[model samples]
Target: MVIAIGFEGSANKLGIGIIKDGEVLSNCRTTYITPPGAGFLPKETALHHRENVLAVLKDAINESKIDVKDIDVVCYTKGPGMGAPLATVAVVARTVAQLWNKPLLGVNHCIGHIEMGRIITGAKNPTILYVSGGNTQVIAFCRKRYRIVGETIDIAVGNCLDRFARILKLSNAPSPGYNIEQLAKKGKKCVTLPYCVKGMDVSFSGILTYMEERAATLLKEGYTEEDLCFSLQEHVFAMLVETSERALAHCNSTEMMIVGGVGCNERLQEMMEIMCQERGATLFATDERYCIDNGLMIAHAGAEMYKSGIRMKWEDCTILQRYRTDAVEATWRKD
Candidate 1:
């Protein structure tokens, strides 16, 4: 009968969610969107979170239909995100925990996504492909750790798409990547882009650089934005699929779960589904609700950790901007 509330402000989005046991009661969020051709800055993003977090939290609690006094734990994302945004959410989480006299737990951002995916999709011991604005990795649960099998050597795939969207001046209303995905659907030509996959790892910086240098020239030479977006997705997603297949083989796992913001892309999901069918594996994925960054993930992961006897003191609840997914012991998982 444990009740937990989680706060997440890792990047541009600020989310608050409430969960009881393993079921999500409510999930609320707001995004700090920047103008076209621009990315969000940490300080500004933090300011947005500070301004909106309380409202979002109120919404979550209200929607959950729970009294604050009933909450047993307060959770927040502690790492692998922008410094200002992470600190902002941590401050709020700490304040709430102290005010409510509840236990506080700090969760790794990546593990939050993975745990949420597992809970929502009911996938057990699946090889995971985590792709987001800040990270790109192929992972598997091994020896109480989410071991990385393959990763990006440079920029994340989402970051690359976002940056390219900026070059194309795509709207950041919902997201740059979403806009790119939509444009790609209308593409009639497939321009060749650099595909950088080195063994188990993939790289997107070279492809981004090539696109940045040639975007204007290619447009003038009869290439549409849709064409460029289509080509970029084709190459990058192929790279991801290739590495993910190898990871599945390496881990000998039959299930593949995709988690993170970019996991919302239908084309990527379609591509992965084809690969899974060929490999005789299952693909587990959630929609934007669980795929993108959200507070429910933090609450879910934190609840798992708390149930497993993990706790944090007030003094120990600090942010780690570079926390790795493998650093946290998956004590909640026995197998």
Candidate 2:
């Protein structure tokens, strides 16, 4: 039984997980809520990571009912995340790997999300709707790697939600998107917002700006804020659902795994699931434990790579803020 400890520090949350043979022992998260008016400032994120990494790590290990010594390998997210958060987690992974004389696996942040969705839902070869603060993509597996079938040309779905949440003065604490979803329940969708999906790719920056302007106008015009919030969620999420359906149709695959922070929205999942049902495809959606960023996915990716005898040279291992999901060189799969 290979026991592994996973560290997810690629972004705002510190996700730690204990797993063996794809079976999760424990998964926990410590969310880093940014200060007001500060949207994921790199220095603040790094500082927060440095302060909480140890506590989160120890708690995860303790809660797993497994000894730290039993961990056969240490897994850490490599990139496609904030540089400071990734570096902070990398140092912890490096230390743990060194101390135990165990192998260290550097996992891709996006792959972690994808893999975790697969593990949670038991969906094999499912297409993916991966949207987050940094990424927006419609992906499918092919050629031993997930291929991007479509994506955003600009900002991600989650970023748009958060930006709108701030525009409405919703809490940036805990989870902004989740908060936005809550406020959306009270919204009446009064104003019409732009929805742009071009050839499998979507753009939100323009719509976001348009909505902001609309909201400002409505507010000055004595319209209720709830009406604006309602309109925003409906339009934004409708765009997401439409894009996902388009991807599902374009790929001709019904199996979709929605992975990322935005996946937590019940509305998004509901629409996607309905689309799949209509198309006779399966849609896999993981819970917060796996859906949100976490370390276990990274560890699992690392273990798979290591078992296949793939190892990255120390000199070549560096943090990447931008990595194409399909750009994975190789998985070290022996098959």
Q: What tens-digit string does per-residue lDDT give for candidate 2 at 286-331?
A: 7776778887787777666666667766655567778778887545
Q: Please report the TM-score between candidate 2 and the true structure.
A: 0.93
lDDT of 1 by residue, 200-277 (tens): 999999999999999999999999999999999999999999999999998888999999999989999999999999
* Regions of candidate 2 where Cα sits further than 4 Å from its true position: 329-335
Which candidate number would show the highest lDDT if scored against the true structure?
1
TM of each candidate vs. truth: 0.99, 0.93
Q: Candidate 1, residue 243: CA error in Å?
A: 0.3
Query: What range of 10 consecutive residues in model 1 has the weakest lDDT sum?
Result: 1-10
Error in Å for residue 298 of model 1: 0.2
Model 1 stretches astray by more than 4 angstroms: none
Cα RMSD to the true fold for all candidates: 0.6, 2.0
Model 1, position 178: C-alpha lDDT score: 96
Best by TM-score: 1
Worst 10 residues of 2 by lDDT: 326-335
